[model samples]
Target: MATKNVVVDLTKREKLDGTNFDMWHRKIQYLLNEQEVLETLTIVMMRPENGNTAQHRYDLETYESWVKKDHCARFTMLSSMHNDLIGEFENYPNAQEMWNQLKISYGGTSATILRALTLKFEKYVMDSKHSMAEHLRTMSTLIRDLKAASNNLSNEQ
Candidate 1:
């Protein structure tokens, strides 16, 4: 099991004596430098607790370890992609619109996989971040979009 522990210097968030924003930024820079070293390894898994819960599977703790070691850019990348997934959901005004979009974008098992990925992303953001309730609300909105999309697909079929 290849595992890495991470240390974060959140001086800006830390209530320490003489700690300023500049110090915090500098500390973040150092953290980024360290993270660059870690990304050298292959990302065998994105999330620890994935769709499968087999004997060979690892938990979210494994994924979080990487997240902790990840640089600011990496964190931002995850955030941006998550937002994009939701945005894609929201782009459709109604179920009909969603069905049309999904029809063009995916087919068969691929469609199922794509929807599952979007839903999983919602779960991932809600689980990993501190503000659970708020994230849940966001997930709720996503769920509505997903449901609407499904309805549209059914109507078309």
Candidate 2:
């Protein structure tokens, strides 16, 4: 089988600092999906214990493929994160563990965070001194954060 050479360019994207997890998560997930390695974030493949058989050889190949993909996924993830965050995640044995730990650390919203986000969204006002584009961008960011915190907004909101 011919292997596909995927080039991931994360230079244009913002590194995952503590404050931008939602946007970083969305971008990284899309990158991993495009690389066809997103499954490595959730699935763990094991090497076959038995040897010298056709099934063992096939399983070994499958496991190898998984390893290759897992490495790519892990590298892409690490490359997209900030330097300060890398040390916390670099030692994970597999992409799945790293991904899970990230989700647990940054994905889960505590009640206090949710409330703060909601209040910010509700009280936001467009500043007359700022350009409309800047105001819109700020509003969109607030909306994204609120959604990430599991606070759904209606069209009228």
The number of the candidate with the highest TM-score is 2
- Give the per-residue lDDT of model 2 (tens digit) for 54-141: 9889999999999999998998888878899999999999999998899888887878767777778889999999999989999999
lDDT of 1: 0.41
Give the TM-scores of the predictions, in the order they appear.
Answer: 0.22, 0.71
lDDT tens digits, residue span 85-112, model 1: 4455454433333334434543323455
TM-score, candidate 2, is: 0.71
lDDT of 2: 0.83
Clashes of each: 0, 0
User: Cα lDDT for residue 67, model 1?
Assistant: 51
